[model samples]
Target: MIFFIYQIVTKPLTSKLIRNEACPVCNTQDSLELTLYMRYIAMLIPLFGMGRRTSVICTNCGNVLKNPDSSIFAKKKYSNKVADAVKDIRQNHKRTLWQLVYPWSIWFILPFLILILLGISAINKKNTEEKAKEYAELIMHPQTGDIYKSTWFENGLSQGVLVKLMRINGDTLYVVKTKQKIQMSFSKDEWNKLSADPAAFEAKEYKIKNFSILKETNFGDLFMYNNDENGKQYPIYLGAILNSKCEMDLGFETIERKK
Candidate 1:
């Protein structure tokens, strides 16, 4: 398993010479520079209480000494100038008494935030690919040069019935009106009985104006189940009008290609 790693770093926050003082190592008066500095930590918060120390350096004999405490200044010869500088630094640069360490909880949450964004991106990509596949399956009727050879519900096919796709704009297909050619020609009274049904009509030309894509649509309630008694689901985009009121959904089945 791979894991992400984070690090905490330390850097110098302040470094400056306070004043000239006597070197303790070289025993030279007014020959050393008393310096006080702090090394701050860097992580998720502003932190500074780690190893704050002081260093004294001699100018005459090139000697240096270091200590964690500032009390080494008391061993030197009494100099009012160095003492005033030390007093000013102690008063102005004191660490906060409230917090010796900072809270680090936010650093643990960054990795989880990155994971949630990646999961949402993957789901959206899969949905886009599924939509593209559904569009490719629409049947294209040759005489009309439109519509796909969609799947039919079992026993849904009227014998010798031809479904001619006229035009496809969005999810709706404009089917051209046709006179029944497969069944015996209907009598005038029989024609009147079936005139309202799309299955009872027939078409001759591709350029006819009687083409209507929508049935008696109810704007408030536009989709109803088509006459599939077994509750079989088909692709709505394939012109499978299962219900009187209609909308579209993605298809799972695809047409098998010839090898």
Candidate 2:
């Protein structure tokens, strides 16, 4: 199939005979006829060709001869201008047909372009991972005015809390929402858990009030008054942490959640 192609095929010209002379092979009178056919191969491989062929058939003996040469053939040659014209017609079509199929070579450069695209994709993935690690270091020292956004993660931190610190009292971090003071505390254990997905950490919108921080301790005695939906309060005592920023970098964060 690689040798297949479409092309403009021109018609070949022909002649009747050498006045229907006698056959040289069978010695039959008015039986030998002559013809001139010409064609060339244009595709990768030739399907058919009658390149400069001289065909003769004897009507009386039914003998056929093709491409009979002048030296091997011992018949009286036609000695007129008509015989010379037939030879010229066959020779005109003997040149090369290579120009008809030169465009097929353009399909050879497709594989190199595909490999270049795959190399670019691998480099992009490595850059995204480095950016995620650098972003975690930016929030290492959280201040009272520092604002955080929501965390959208596929891991344990998906749809997590975000808040801006309005006040930091000792180990206590407070944010004001709806004219109410919402206090949060991050113990060593709580900090370790929250910052685990540092890349997904973010600040929350003040109008969005769905967050949770039940088992964290800052104001030691005040945590006793709060709990989950249950009437019990579970507290995680901060282990020698002076500020919420240091606690957050340790992996803990606080969010308000509805019971």
Candidate 3:
């Protein structure tokens, strides 16, 4: 019984296996020894799965086995998945020619748009300045009063002189000295030129007087002509109008004095 048990223990397990050994279960010499490599391959089948290439099976007993060749398995699976993905991508791919062109087109177009906007703004600013200057020039000229409706002048020289003159009455003109420090000044002749023809004055040469502050309520006109004061009765053009101010000079010279 011990010898029988030893025979059974020493026997091979499968018939289709490569080695000629007796069967362990029945003690029959018809059994064959299973190859270690084949056993190893069989063990790896479930682990590797059906996706693998090198498969195995016992020819006589028909036992399913695994043969995991990592290189072949990986290559076949990777190739199949990659091929399927490539086919799907090809089917779904849309040709967007506009997408490639838009960014570069915007790079050129944006600058042109900016330049056009800047040009329009500059034109608007120029027109505003010209209108202001024209109004200022018109207000400066004593004769232009009939041409424009709302226009007035205040002191001797609005731009040139620091000392602002105010008309007290027909006989006297009051002088208001400015406390705020200013740099520019005008000569008597320069003041005369400005008073005579304000259009002739250059904007770059002189700054506009502070017209907002010097109104009729704060500082009256320096030279107001009554019926008897001047030979011809005309209102003084000494205050600030729309754009330009009265020609300011060093001396508080009235319109009568200027004449």
Per-prediction CA RMSD (Å):
17.4, 18.2, 27.7
For model 2, state the Cα shift of residue 118 in Å. Answer: 3.5
The C-alpha TM-scores of every prediction are: 0.27, 0.25, 0.22
Better of 1 and 2 by lDDT: 1
Over 1-259, each residue of candidate 2 has an lDDT whose tens digit, in order, gives: 3655744333334545545455666766666555654444545554444334555556677666543433334563543433554565556534455423333433554566666677776665555454433333333333455444323232333332333446555444554212111123334443333432324333332221111232232311112123568867444321211222232342322322222
Q: After superposition, which runs of candidate 1 have C-alpha atoms over 4 Å from their true positions? A: 1-20, 40-51, 68-223, 229-259
- Candidate 3, residues 144-240, lDDT tens digits: the string is 1121111222244334333333333333433343223222333445333333233432232211222222333322233344455556655445432
Give the C-alpha lDDT of model 3.
0.34
Task: Please report, as a residue range, the 10-residue window in candidate 2 with the lowest summed lDDT.
Answer: 205-214
Best by TM-score: 1
Best first by TM-score, ranked = 1, 2, 3
